[model samples]
Target chain A: MSQELYTNIAIFVLSILVGFEVISKIPSTLHTPMMSGANAIHGVVVVGTILIALEAHSVLFYVIAFIAVFLASINVSGGYVVTDRMLQMFSKPKKTDDQKQDGGDK
Target chain B: MYLVSAACYVIGLHMMRTPKTARNGNRVSAVGMIIAVIMTFLIVINKHEATMTGSIVLAAGLILGLAYGTIRARTVEMTDMPQLVSLFNAVGGGAAAAIGTFDYLSLTAGSHISFAFSFPVALDLVIGGVTFSGSLIATGKLAGNISGKPISFPGAKLLNAIVVIVIVAAVVLTIGFPVNAWWLVLTLVASLIFGILMTIPIGGADMPVVVSLLNAFTGLAVAMAGFVIDNQALIIAGALVGAAGTILTLQMAAAMNRSVMNIIAGGFGTGDSNSAAAD
Candidate 1:
């Protein structure tokens, strides 16, 4: 493997650990919003879509890149918009590490 | 700049640990994405590249996606959020897979790529295609277009196993051989089939976990795409989602009193009448 792969893998492993820690204390009620939020985060694929479109020479490449961008942006925009909508409905603020049992807010 | 955007994703997710802070977290994450996009645009402009047509195509895609995504997110009923999320996962998966396929095609224009490239690209396409089709089916199940009842053909496990083998072969061939376009095709088709087969066997209370797992798959695929393209931003974002999604999947499964392996390995309603492990 190349040194780049080594670096990427290290970054990848560390990020996963960070990810697990960041949301580990969340309640079950927040699952949907959490998933939606995570969905939005992955929409970073849009970066790839943009770079690909700029470099594509063939019509086929352009078309594929265009479709990728369109889908990825939807993922980014819709993901965050909907997540915020869901989180808005909850009037109570979640206290981290205080309440273990779920559906208490309901 | 890429690292900065990735840091935004991390901090944004950290903020999401609470409800009062979640919306701001989302906003922060979006801002990070904005930074990444602007940085990319500046780089492109500085290069003095991109044909006029390419610019127009990019503009149209951005506009159309932003409009549709924003409008739909605004209007969809709260009850349908899961379905909408699944659809988003589908699109995200398809987009990542498209980038992988495009890159694969470009690289194999007459030569072979090393395992470093083929490994990530092949896996990305497989996961991406699986998440793409599987999320759509999940969306259908959630939206009532398809039966929520678990449905599986006789010998479904064997069939899925066969598809798994095909995918493995394709991946191996992609690495062993000179990066033929056909290997990627095989990989995509097989994984798509695998996704459908695995999802159709799952239904009812298990839907949420399935969707969450697929979300994780999409994230993992995006991360693989990042490795393929050697981009730090994609890797960070993808890894974050993948990790978060996995935790969500396990938590949901636990809430339902089932194990993650059991949820997946149990093959709920696999036509075995005596199998009530999930029932």
Candidate 2:
């Protein structure tokens, strides 16, 4: 195998290890949000779609590239927004007016 | 610069371990993606490889995608987040497979064929095809379009085995005779069918694990495309996604008290009416 391919494989293996370690400690309550967050990160595939567009020469190729770009953009934007919305639910509830007034008096 | 982007992803994912930092982590990841996109555009423009028409098409795609994604993300209920995520996974996987298809066509058309390129293209098609269709089925199940209970028929396992054998044979044929594109197409068709069959029998309680597994398939597919196209950034990003998705899949499976092996075999969660009731 070529050195480049080997390098890529090494990167792949190391990333797997990092992925395991990083996610191992997550609580079950956070699993959904974590999945959503990871979904957004994979939106990095949009970069690949852009690269493909550079080589698209025919109408058919252009169409394919366009769809890819569009789909990837959705993965990126939708993933993040949905994740944010989900995470917001896990945040502490806002203080009521009475609570705020009591704090102010203190 | 890709290294910087990769680092950001790692840090961003790390920060997600806590609720307080998860949102910020997501933003950090987004920033990384923005940088990667801009850098790729600059490189392509500098090489004068992107045509005016191509640029216009790309811009239009971005705008449309951004609008659709924003609306869908904003409107989707939290209860439906898994379904939405499955849909996103479907598109990502489909796009990666499409890239492989385009590359294969162009390569064969030019009469330039090598195992190095052909192997990755074939692998990408199979994995991407499976991910695309499997994710759609998962979405259907999660959204109540399909029964959440495991659906199995007589000889389902035997049929699944035969499909696996056919896919392997097709991949071998593509590698041995790179000029005949039929084998590659056959692989894609069979994998897509297999994807549907594989997911339909998985119970609803396992949809999250299935989604994560499909996400990993997309990652592997993207990484294979990187190999086909000789892009380091694609390789790095795709590998990270694959690894992360795999870990998440395992975690999800464990959370449901099912082994990943059992989940893949397609029968353990079939009779759990109680699980379905809880959902």
Candidate 3:
């Protein structure tokens, strides 16, 4: 293996260890939402989709690349939105009056 | 830029350790994604290989998918979150597999073909295909579209055996011989079948753990794709997800008084009427 491949492998292995340690003491109520949030993070596949589009020459290539982009974008956007919704339910805004301002900021 | 985004993801996940800060965790992760997406798009646009038609197709897909994803996310009922999560896995896996397939084809057209490239390509096809089909079936079961009971037919075991044997053969062929598109395609088809077979016999009660397992499969597939392309960000993000999913699977299984081994081995569930009740 080349140096680059070796580095990538090390990165992958170390990241897995980090992932295992990323969340701790999370309540049962947060499991589903936390899972959803993690799901959204993998939407980084969207980056790959765009990278492939750079070399799409044939119609078949373009079509496949398009599907890749489409599906990945869905994963990215939907995952985040769905996660945010769930997390919001567990969120308690103490002062209801400033809710509008908070919403505006968001 | 990619490293920064990756840091954001780790920070986001760290914040998820507590309920009070979990919402912000989601935002931080989303922000990471936005940075990565914009940076990738800019790279694509600046490249001389980029074409107007390609840009149009990419943008169209991005916009359309974004609109639908947001609408579905905003409108779907909370009770349906499991299925929705499965759907996300489906898309993520499918996308990763598609990208790997494209890269494999592109690489074969050239002279330099190495084991490192081909192995990950084949692996991605298998893992991504399984995650794609498995998650879809899980989604169906969760949505009540498919029977949540263990579905064992006369040849179910035989088919499962056949699929596994074929996949193993394809993996060997994929690694030893010169690059063949059929090997990749066969690997994908067999893995997809295996995924379906594995999920169908699992009852409703074990769907959460199964979903988490398939979620991990999707992550590994993406990581394999990263290997094919030599992309660090994908490796980090995908591996992080793979580890987290595995932990979540085991955690949920333990919480439900089930073992990951038995849950993976299937037949633990007798079609529990309250499947998501454990959640």
Candidate 4:
């Protein structure tokens, strides 16, 4: 088999194993955060598109690569940012009944 | 070499799945990644005809990437962990897209478009583009960079539908008439704009669904890229990503006591859902 073919197969296997490994370590409490982070990796699509666009000898391929990278980057970045903020919401302070009672007494 | 990559992925997945064992998982994953990197270099050096300069540059890239990964791993706060994850995923998607692009460009270098590869390239392009935009929007909403208030203009869904139609038409034209490369660029720009529009309407709480969906798109795009390059690894990796993303979307929907269809159809949780149970 060609070296390229062999390398591709290697990458495919690695991705799967990594996917499982990464997911497995996530805590139940942090599932959303973890998911968000992983999802954000989708942004790599931008780099991919750039590579494709530059390397593609034809205008058509270039255009396609550009779009793919542009769109995927948004998805990856936007998704993670949102998730981070949402998780932050969990750590906020909640009002206690005692505090409310004290204020009422005052 | 393949085994090394697989090991890295496995270790990473393990860390991801078992939060209590995150440290160990991370360590394993890291080591695996290092091995994978080594394998990649070995493969390139073993087969590809390249000058010493090219080899040095490639080595530098790998080292830089490793350094970045290590730094991020050590310094990133647990609260920002999700964001980090997203960043990594984006890099992966980008890498796959880049490789696919290289394959396509090499084939079409002589101005004679190879129909066999063009389709996959297009698939990767469209899907990758959409995924990138969608992820960015999701990140903005999550990070408070943008409002998560399900912004809806009149006939937003209709507009989205129109955009999809146009994109499809453009795709058809691109394939049927390779001579018209402009259509590809036009559609790409249009779709990106449409991605932003589609995402702006999604509220914060529904962000998970959006993230999941975009991830699926990323996977599909990678898989297509794989097809274009006739790379088994890309195809398998892409399919795995797509499947995993879809499953997560469903889980998120269930968490909201909503179905995937409801999430996609739009008009969810106009803010009152905050009082409603996330369950």
lDDT of 3 by residue, B73-116 (tens): 99999899889999998999999999988987775532447788
Off by over 4 Å in 1: A92-106, B268-279
lDDT of 2 by residue, B106-176 (tens): 66442547777788888999998999999999999999999988888877778888999999998888776
Task: Please say which candidate is ahead in TM-score: 1 or 3.
Answer: 1
TM-score of the second chain in candidate 1: 0.94
Cα lDDT of model 1 by residue, B141-258, tens digit:
9999999888876777688878999999998988788857888889999999888988887888888999999999999999999998888888888988999899989998888898
Query: In candidate 1, what are the lDDT values of residues A1-106, reduced to their tens digit?
Result: 8788999999999988988888787878778888998999898898888888887888988898899889999998898898888878773444443264444664
Q: What is the Cα-based TM-score of model 1?
A: 0.93
lDDT of 4 by residue, B187-218 (tens): 56666666677677787577767777776777
For model 3 chain A, give the 10-residue run with minimal summed lDDT.
Answer: A89-98
* TM-score to native of every candidate shown: 0.93, 0.90, 0.91, 0.66
Q: What lDDT score goes with residue B78 in model 1?
A: 86
Give the Å error, residue B141, model 1.
0.3
Interface RMSD per candidate: 1.6, 2.1, 1.6, 7.9
Each model's total of backbone clashes = 0, 0, 0, 76
- lDDT-based ranking: 1, 3, 2, 4
Q: How displaced is residue A14 in candidate 4, in Å?
A: 13
- Using alpha carbons, what is the TM-score of model 3? 0.91
> How high is the CA lDDT of each candidate model?
0.87, 0.81, 0.85, 0.54
- Give the C-alpha miss distance for residue A12 in model 2, angstroms: 2.4
Q: Could you give me the TM-score of model 4 versus the true structure?
A: 0.66
Tens-place lDDT per residue, model 3, A18-70, is 98887545677777887888889888888888888767888988999999999
Model 2 regions lying over 4 Å from their true place? A93-106, B110-112, B268-279
* DockQ per model, Cα: 0.59, 0.56, 0.63, 0.11
